[model samples]
Structure formats: structure tokens, C-alpha cells
Target: MAFPILATLVVLIALATLVPLSRRTTWLVRDLDFPRLQIAAVALAVLVAQLSLLDLRDYETVILLAITLACLAYQAWWIIPYTRVFPNEVKAAVSGDRDERLRILTANVLAPNHNAEGLLALIREHRPDIFVTLESDAWRQRHLDTLEDEYCHAMKCPLDNLYGMHVYSKLPLEDTAIQFLVEDDIPSMHAMIVLESGRKVRMHFLHPAPPSPTEHEESTERDAELLVVARSVADLDTPVVVAGDLNDVAWSTTTRLFRKISGLLDPRIGRGMFNTFHAGIPLFRWPLDHLFHSKHFTLAHIQRLPAFGSDHFPMLVELAYDRRHGATQEGLEADAEDEALADEKIAAEPVSEADVHEPQA
Candidate 1:
């Protein structure tokens, strides 16, 4: 009993602190940073579980194993919008007056994946009015044009590399604009969209690359881009919808801060963790794709799509905000320590004087 509980704590601690200890890796799987850490965490956990079987029928050992599994669940699914230990990231309080009811889908079609026909088929089948794609190329641009009639309003920033981005929509776009908010060549799209019901939402689409020595060197720029957006949403007078690959899990400190800052509702809460990445492999799959909305909009449906030649499986969300009660909130969910930590995280993000510019007209 004591041994298993003790071992479980050790494993949870490892998972929690893996990022800070292993500065070399940020992502846990694929050819990325978190791969080794995730593997080690799982391997160590399995060893702990097997070691406990030494005393079969031991109720305490069984209980400890269950508890250990529970901890793993919490780490992966729950702990995000409420981290308390690390307060070094930027955070802003959620604010807004009206909820914008609209449905949107964001996906990252790996540039190298040639079988994009399936993805297009899925898009046509689901028929989301608003679609955002990351890691796109020219071939993708031509193939995706099939929706040009359906989505008359569109923005395309195609590149030969993985940074290509595109946004297509049927909604009336106001102030539709694209900018490289952080790094040049890597673009993000932001625009005002009005739904058929007269509801207007400030939609921001982001797909910033994650932090690793080989990537952007550190999360400074990533944190800054998110903080800038978070602050923008926090200051908004209307409901907002920000979505994309994010490159970070929906439950990461940064994402949580974005939710808190934007006052958005994660449909996944109380719902299952919809792992979106690693569709090519089973053992390494997790939810990297996400959809979050203002409280006014209720989730009509949210699901992970089948693989379409990309490592990430796209997510589709149907939202309706014509609620009887208006927008409800999750409240100021973070503690002062974590809140301050978030403040620091945002503050410490690297910002250049040239980075600040007036929003494009």
C-alpha cells in the first residue's frame, strides 16, 4: 500500500515537472521535445504498476494503482486552466458583455500529406461555415478552392513551407486581416465575423510554432503572441472565438491563460479529452486540436475527425448561442499565486519595440 502510493506520487511528480527538467524538449512525442519525457513517464508508470502485482489481492496496492491512473488522467485532462505552482506566465482576467454564437472548425493539414482529398471530403461532408487550415501549401490552396463558391470570403497566405495559413468563411467579414503578430513569414489571421443571426465575433486564428532549441529557441515569442491576444480578448466588449493548432495542449498554462483572459468556455470540461495529434500512431496520440467559445454559446457538437494523411486529426464544433440565460462564467478560477505567475509569464515573454503596430485596416 505505502509502496504503491509512494511510487504513484513519484510518477505524477515526474510528469508534472518533466518540462522544466528537460529543457531540451517541449513536445513529448513525434520528432519533438516531449517524446522522451512522455515515453519515460509511461514506462516508469508501467514499471510501478507491474511492481505492485508482487502482492496480489493486496487491496492497498490496487487502490494505489487506481489512484495513480487517476493522477495521470488529471494531468492530461484537468489541471490546465488552474495551474497554481508556476506563476511566471502572462494571464489576464476574462471580460466581455455579449456572447457570440457561431460554429467554426480549425485544422492543420500537414504539408507533406498528399492525400488531402480525404480532408476536403470531410470538410464538404461536415460543412462548417468557417474553416482555418495551418501548414498548408499551394497544392492545398488549389484543392481547397472547391469551396470558393461556398466561402466567398477568404484569406490565403500560402508558403512553400509549413507556415502556410488560410481562412475561408461564409460569414460576412468585417475588418478581415492577417498579420505575423510574432515572427515574420509565420502568419496569424484575425477578423470580425458576423453570423447570420446578427451576432458578431472577433475571431483570431493562431498557429504559432512551439518552443524548442531548434524551433524558436524559447517560448518567449509564443507566450507573447498568446498574451497579446489574451489581452485583446479580455478587453473585448463582445464575445470572442480564438482557435487553431496553438501547438500547445488546450490544458497547458498558456491555453488556460488564454481561456481565462478571453473568458471562453471549453466544451471539453466534464467531457472527454479529445486527443487530436498523433493520428499516425496509437500509443502517442493526444488532443492538440481544440475549440473554445464564449459562455453565451452552447456546444452543439465537438468531435475528432478520422485521419486524413496528417498527424493531427481536425476537430469540428457546432455552437449555438441563442441561450435563454445569456452567458454564464467559470469565474476567477486561478489562485493569486498562479495568477501572479501567469502575469510573470506574460511579462517575461520577449517583445521587441518594432513588434508593436496599429491593427491593420
Candidate 2:
């Protein structure tokens, strides 16, 4: 009875591992990508237990163990980049140039979370040049409005639909637009901020809908939005920074594709999994918020700040934009297949002028 039960569990784990590899965008399939770490840990434990206790007398037991091992390897390959084992994708700035450094702090304050004081404290301590908030409604906007005294140049889209976003920057923001790339309710902020050195770097703040019970039924819209933005910035020469609650895991196929298509570098790669979501439950947390930048930038400091009564802990990243290292940092190149998939995803949902707008200055 124990052998049969163990075999069944191994088979189930293998199936879960295989589900994420499927191209299906359904919530059931997409949600599997979020818990890759947890799944890998459980699979590893099962494999060790089977080897230690079970006798491999039968061919069935041998095949089951083989499949389990393969599943663990697959998960590890996807996760290894976020661990310390892999080489760093964004190298640290060898020269400390204050004029070239820009610190960005991004947070997704749960709409109902009223811990404004906690978040305010983090902002004061970090004192980022640019700060972003997602799921920020009119209420949260009121609290965040106090930041205007410090961040003179700002863009606000305080909607009550839970997709609202606000960007506060001490630096000068230019050509700022609030665009809805796919769904009408979902909003993304696009702007060009002139740094202290008088260099203009484009910034994109996005909070795409996640594949969940109450949110999106499939990841089609979210995937399309990211791919559209990826395609737009693939050829840009200036520094680019895309940050916010992406609503997708760092290791997901969609995000990996986005990185390749956009030619962006992930600071989290080879550093650590700065898991931001599910602050209440440590075991279930994964990195849903992200900061991906162009090859022109190098890492200075990146950290996950303490929770502030929200489901997500804020993420702060300081990047040094040096044009000299533009060619040095290698980005994931998109091949023919990656380009084709990006096109398909973008064509699935196209944005128009009606979906784009500039905030009231």
C-alpha cells in the first residue's frame, strides 16, 4: 500500500512539473509557474525519500524515480539563474559615479491595506529618485499625495479598479503617458525622466492582471501587454527601466520571453529571489514584482524592503546607467521562434490611441 501511494504521488508531481511547459495560457496552467520553487523542493524530498526507503525491485519503481529526477532537473534549470550559482547578469558598477546612479523603489500596496505610515517610512529611508505604487486607488493616492512636496514631478492615475498606478519622481519626468496596452481597466505608465546628469532614460511602470480566480481567466492579456512593450523597446538606444508588479514570476516562460525580446537585463539574475508577494505567508511567496533594465545599466544595490500591511513587500533597486558598458552586458537575444511568439502575443491584443493618455500636469 505504501509503495502504491508513493508511486501515485511521484506521478502527480511529475504531471504538475509538465503542466508549466505547456503553451496553454489558462489560469490553471499559468498559475503553476508561480510556485516552481516550492514544487522543486517537494519533488526533491520525494525523490530522496523514495531512494532511501523504497526497494527498486520493479521496473515501475525505477521508471518513476527516473521521471521524478527529470522533473527536479527541469525546475532547477529555470530557477538556477535566480540563485547564487549562476553568474550575475547585471554587473556591479566598478566606478562609483553619483551622477550616473538612479535609485527606484516600487511597491504594490494592497488596495485595502491602510498602513500608509509603514510605506512612508520606507520611502523616507531609501529616498529613491523615482518611486512607483500599484493597486493604488484614490485613497492610497491621498496618502501618497503627501510625497508631492518631495517628488515635484509626478504622474497620477488613481482609479478604484485596483489597477491604478502612480509614479512619484524627484527627477524631471517628460512625455509621460498612462496607457492601457490590452484590457481597458489595466493601466501602465510610460515616461522619460531626466537624471541628475541630464541624461534622459525611459521608464515604464506596469501592473498587469494576474491569472487568478478574481482577476484574469487566462494570461493572454498579461502576456500580450508585456510582449507589446518588449517589442517597442527592443531597438531603443537610450537606457530603459521597466518595473512594477508584473503579476508574473521571474522564471515564467512569458517573462523569460519578454527579457529576450526586449534585450533587457534582470538585476535579480544570479543575485537572489527577491520575493515580494504574499508577505503574510512566507512559504507561498514568490517574486511577482520585477525590475528589468537595458544593457546600459549596472547594479548598485537591490533589496526587498519590509512589508507595510500589504501583500507585497517593496523592492528598491539602484542602477548606474553608464553608456560605456552598453556593449559589455550581454542580453538574451531573441531568435526566430521567440520573435514569432512575441508577434503572435502582440497581435492577439493591440493597443490604440484611445487607450493612451497623458496625465493632467
TM per candidate: 0.76, 0.96
How many pairs of residues collide in model 2? 0
lDDT of 1: 0.66
On a 0 to 100 scale, what is the lDDT of residue 224 in model 2? 84
- The local distance difference test score of each candidate is 0.66, 0.87
Q: For model 1, how does the per-residue alpha-carbon lDDT over 156-264 read when each residue is reduced to its tens digit?
A: 9998769899998988778777888777877888787887767777777888777755686566567667766766665445666778887776555566666766566
C-alpha RMSD of each candidate structure in angstroms:
7.0, 2.3
Instruction: Say which candidate scores most in TM-score.
Output: 2
Candidate 1, run of 10 with poorest lDDT: 88-97
lDDT by residue (tens digit), candidate 2, 163-265: 8899999999998888877888888999988888888888888999988888878888899888777777777787888899999999999999999998999
Indicate the residue-level lDDT of 25 in model 2. 85
Please state the error at residue 163 of candidate 1 in Å: 1.3
